[model samples]
Target: MSTSSNRQMKLAAYVMAGPVSGHHGGWRYPSAQHDILDVRFYQNIGRLLEDGKFDMMFVPDIQALPRRLGDSLASQLTHGALGALRLDPMLVLTAIAASTQRLGVAATISTSYFAPFHIARSLATLDHLSAGRAAWNIVTSFQDAEARNFGLKEQLSRDERYDRADEFVEVACKLWDSWHDDALMWDRATPQFADPSRVAPIDHHGRWFDVEGPLNVSRPPQGRPVFVQAGASERGKDFAAKWAEVIFVTHSSLASAQAFYQDIKERARSFGRDPDQVNVLLGMVPVVGETESIAKDKQALLDDLCDPEAGLSTLSYQLDVDLSPFPQDQVLPDLEVGGVQGHYREVAELTRKQNLSLREIGKRYGVGPLRDFNGTGGEVAGRMQEWFDARACDGFMVQMPYLPGGIEDFVRLVVPELQTRKVFRADYTGTTLREHLGLDRPAH
Candidate 1:
């Protein structure tokens, strides 16, 4: 490690597949590769993350797609012009785990639809499979389609969802604790697989769920996988303060980022926790090229691929308001309110702040501008440093502009610059996500 980088911040990458481009039409770029459903795709991505010295590559999963796109899921599915497909992040993470040694793997699972025990076992097992390098991006499924898939007519109210999430995480912690660190004693001589007394059932009966007993997997090497949360509402902040080790935040401007960062850290302090214990990571969708002009040109080309129908469809699903009737070039007003509060509000704020027309805002969805970094390696690195210095965030969640190439560009060009500037690591100092984040490892 470089001495100069000791005081600098850290960074992580987040990879979602089929079409995880920051902009609506990102995946359509000639250079962008797909077939992410294949296990090898993730393995390759993982090896790149490990080679790049990234803290981790988080994969966010959602139980349902934007069924609200139209009367059927076909428009959303056919919106290939729009970048909006996601594979099951957990299964992909497992493939990644097998290919890398030290890179941490994190995946999102919704607390709204999943049982606490189920979450506990799956995450703990992942931590074990990855040898202590796993992170869980705790989330609540927001779409009504997701609710229906769980055999419900509608999603729970926001407050109720968060309430259930609180209890869900609480139960997960208990189950993780149920199997003490030394609970397993693989004594070949005595033929004892594990200490039965050490493993006890949680017997948790909460308002939202009833889970009993210990997780099938033993306590992971890191004790519990690193907890991550991303909600921007008031209740969401409180939840983050209580449980999140890494808080993924999205804001269009530096001012907004600083405000949210300070507010969440102060809230953590009020919770009797070290504010620094939670690493605030800003999500930045990066589009980079060898030269500034080349990068901008590439971005423009990618932007051209957007389908107005597709973009509006996505916006409808996200904002819960259909803009299809509105002219594609028209500007969106603050006419409707919907969805979770993190990035949606930021998108609205971006239009007002930049005096963007409705068409411009819709274009923004197709090729996101509310929160992204686009430039040559040097330019991109400088912007990241500025955000870090401003105390706007402790780190960044690198969102790929294109598969493989998007990630490859950052690693090959931006990573070196960042390392030379001593703002990012050139080698990993530890194996687990928590250790890499500089958090104290839990007592065994």
Candidate 2:
């Protein structure tokens, strides 16, 4: 909305309240805490993010042990190579919300798996509890294991999943809208309660679901909780354009990021929505230190713990191909992979460009460094400004490589530098997540 030099970039923290964070074995770090079961551990993170003046802290949920490579789930669990244990992200987010007043609390749930009414009611209730600072990260669960758990033989095809997601969101929105803002009347003088005319049942019949709604919860303070989606595929992008207020992406290069930023905005425009309302946030993993050399050393620390076999297998799952049968040195075949087409396309291009073998790809998984920011405070801050100024992304979801240490480094070292440059806020100027992100509250 303003000149390039004057605009301030937004930042959110992406976390998973699992046993490990950052790289595969990040929980094994000397400084990393092992108390995943404790409520205090999560509250502390919420406070830290709030102190950093971060716009939001969002946690994604994985329903199952998303294992694809190496030998078994036991191997990865034994090594703590990936997220070791799972907790309900919603439960953790509520704990965070109870502790932090202003910080945005976001949690993910699968639209593909959960009933629309269930999600709509849950998020609405959370929004009320969080006092308008709640957000929902809508996901169409991709794990075959999760599908099996739901008593399905296979995951729906990508198109089918998105179609169902479209309907899922439709139903949720209707439920959220079923009760008007003034529907509740606490006029005790006349012994009156909610006005019935202000609430209507949404008789929704769709290909994916049928929900007779009037969600049990009241309308949320935010009108609807902020809708966040992280899907970079073509179908994913289009679906995001219409329903997502915040879109998360994974891109290897600035050029591709810029292309995505432009495309999503244009796609939003074509949908008769203001493009500015949609924030496209890229996932960034930064390793910051007091000095450039120190940062590189920290980067080396994670690289050593990277589990190539585990990483490659996970990649295979993302690409929807079974790489388990292939040799380490076998070249990734040019055959089309299913699941996430965007991920497949990005990796295919990388493989061709670098002529990388499966072994090389595997090692690069958590170890190789995706969006690495390795340098001193000033050096790292300058790089982030370049991306923001270049319009490559609206902002970043800082994927902290470790736990408190990863978060502390950026907040202590890099944040001040950004504030000094007038490219990031020193203090929060708003209360609700929408106001913090410069988005308007939804109108009834």
Candidate 3:
């Protein structure tokens, strides 16, 4: 890791292998790519991000379609809201790994739905395939729709889910450490395979799981895949502090970001971890243009194309409440929700501060995170540098307003400005995701 005086920003591309990103209207954008199902589309993305010197390309996933609002999938399907048509993230990331050399590939996996052995084996295999460029974004499946798909009637409560997740990750780490790094023996003259004594069973018995024996896969190249997380609630923050290496987060202002940054770092210190190793990345949508006015015009065009119902549908699924019955023009009422309490708090705070109606909030949410940095390439880089210098974030998770075009614009425009300022990498100096992010590899 670089010293405090010369720390560089870590950049990651937050993406989905689906029509929608954070913006519901993205797919309709004329310049956006439509062949999402093709593996070549993702391979091209991997190559583009690698060429841009991005640290990683992280893909978020959902297990089920959005059917929370009005008990129908029409709004999500018709408008291409997120989760309407999603592919398995791991499969898409595996394809990207085959085509790229240095770009890190991360896929979201839920601890609530999957067994520890399954996650450990899958990520171990990915680490080997990518040559140590794999990361796992940990999430406790928030939506009830996801729970139903896993043979449960509803999702677990917030605290309960985290409790299980804490155990879940523990078991996975144990499984990964079951085999010693030097266990393998490729020498044919010895006429022996891996040393049996060096590989032993991890007799783990916990409240959430009971797994015995070693993982079927060998130890990963990184020892363990780098941990990525985006938990914002009180319990969630504690979990991130304990386990997350690359922390993805969203905030409406610099002050909020700074507060979160400080809190998480302090929490990590309390957990006996080095704060520098916990990299906090703020989620940002950068709409680039040659001039500031052109950028505003581009953002306006995106907002105009948005379908309000689509945003409400996504919000409903996220909050686990049917927002369709509420009056659109009236102030949004506060309601206790079970899904993603942090998201609910953010949206609720926005409504209170702005006196925004349900209709206004929905429209804003559809456009994705608040576009706090939208201008010319130099202007956008200036804002990013300000945040990095102020310790508001270690970096930015570049969320695209549209696919290839949005990514292309940032790489062509803002990246050069950042490189010129020497605040971001001009070229990759490391091979693994851990190295790219300046994190220490975990010992087995």
Candidate 4:
């Protein structure tokens, strides 16, 4: 395979601490582990990803259960839907960080419900504990169920949420910058603990938040944890352009992925940021096997195991619309949604392009996004190399169909092929997450 620019692909394992990662039927797989609450389960995953030389392990979080369909959680609970059960991503990532030495740990923490100081402190602590291998996935949660958990009647409008998020990040950056690198002084002769002149309060006053103070923790080893985001809306893209170092995105085709990649890079440049510094990672679901037929059978099995209602329920929650009212045989009508606009757009495109009914979409959604990388290791690696060469993405955020096994398969099969092709690293060369991504640490 012909190589692209000496730039190596950056791979991150998109994961969740729930039974379901992306595929609703994943937990039902015979080899899938159900011991999600066990830290060892996550640690094993960490070691597996590190063993494969993945750049990072990313964990996405949801604070509440799926209740958008008929205002009931029965379908979700019964089928073990995506959001049926979730643990705190930060805590899960910490466990992973403890077991793995080189793999970076990224945790999703919503800006909507958390104060700037709280998030800054938590991420800084994680960065320190992990010895600089830390990243924060910034999210402005769109679910009303999530808002309700924090005593709000409903979520703010999309624009409003983005506005708040912009300010929220501003405050967080200030807090993270509160402590200078030279603030800590352990001079035994002078008996001085820290240099007071080097440390100062942020004294940030914004429309959304007002915080006065320096972070209690010392400056993180990374200076600041790497910022990750998955915003596909126009406003969301702008926010990402301004702040996100790693951009996670989902696309159904190479053309779509290319469009987003170019658009985001342009947006980053417009924001006075180097486009190359912003890594755009496309979400990919890899169903691999020793042979193409075996891979097909594995995919078919996942499809057979899927509960359509579980997919619809999770979809409903994502779109903030009840799918139960829509006829299963009819095409989903275009409607203004208050939830994840990007996801809604993807679903709508699928319906329009294929003229698919709600039932058809549900079954497909339950199996997760249809991927081009479902074959033998060589085939999967070839397709990935194609995307990388085409500049469709900086790399991929691999979403597994099943837990440990799914990741285990890719690591064993595809990783070696990519390494041989010289499009991916054979080993980690950096300690900090920023260094892994080739991003410079922000100046305090």
lDDT of 3 at 68: 88
After superposition, the stretches of candidate 3 with alpha carbons farther than 4 Å from their true spots are 1-4
Greater-lDDT candidate between 1 and 4: 4
- Model 1 scores what on Cα lDDT? 0.80
What TM-score does each of the candidates earn? 0.94, 0.96, 0.98, 0.98
lDDT of each: 0.80, 0.81, 0.90, 0.89
- Model 4 reaches what TM-score against the true structure? 0.98
On a 0 to 100 scale, what is the lDDT of residue 235 in model 3? 93
lDDT of 2 by residue, 194-312 (tens): 89999999998878788888988889999998989987678888889988889988777889889989999999999999998899888778888898888888777777767676567
Clashes of each: 9, 1, 0, 0
lDDT of 3 by residue, 1-444 (tens): 356568999999988889877577788887889999899999988898998999999999988998889999998898888878888989999999999999999999999999999999999999999999999999997888899999999889889999999999999999989999988987799877888888989999988899996998889999999999988889999999999998998877788789989999999999999999999998888889989998899898888889888788889998888898999999889898877776787788789889989988888788885677799999999999999898999999998889888988899999999999999989988899989988888888
Candidate 2 ranges with C-alpha deviation above 4 Å: none
Per-residue lDDT for 372 in model 2? 48
**Whole-structure CA lDDT of model 4:** 0.89
lDDT of 4 by residue, 360-407 (tens): 888878787656878999999999999988999999999999999999
Task: Give per-residue CA lDDT, model 1, range 245-279, as digits (tens).
Answer: 99998788889999999999999999988887889
Tell me the lDDT of model 4 at 264. Answer: 91
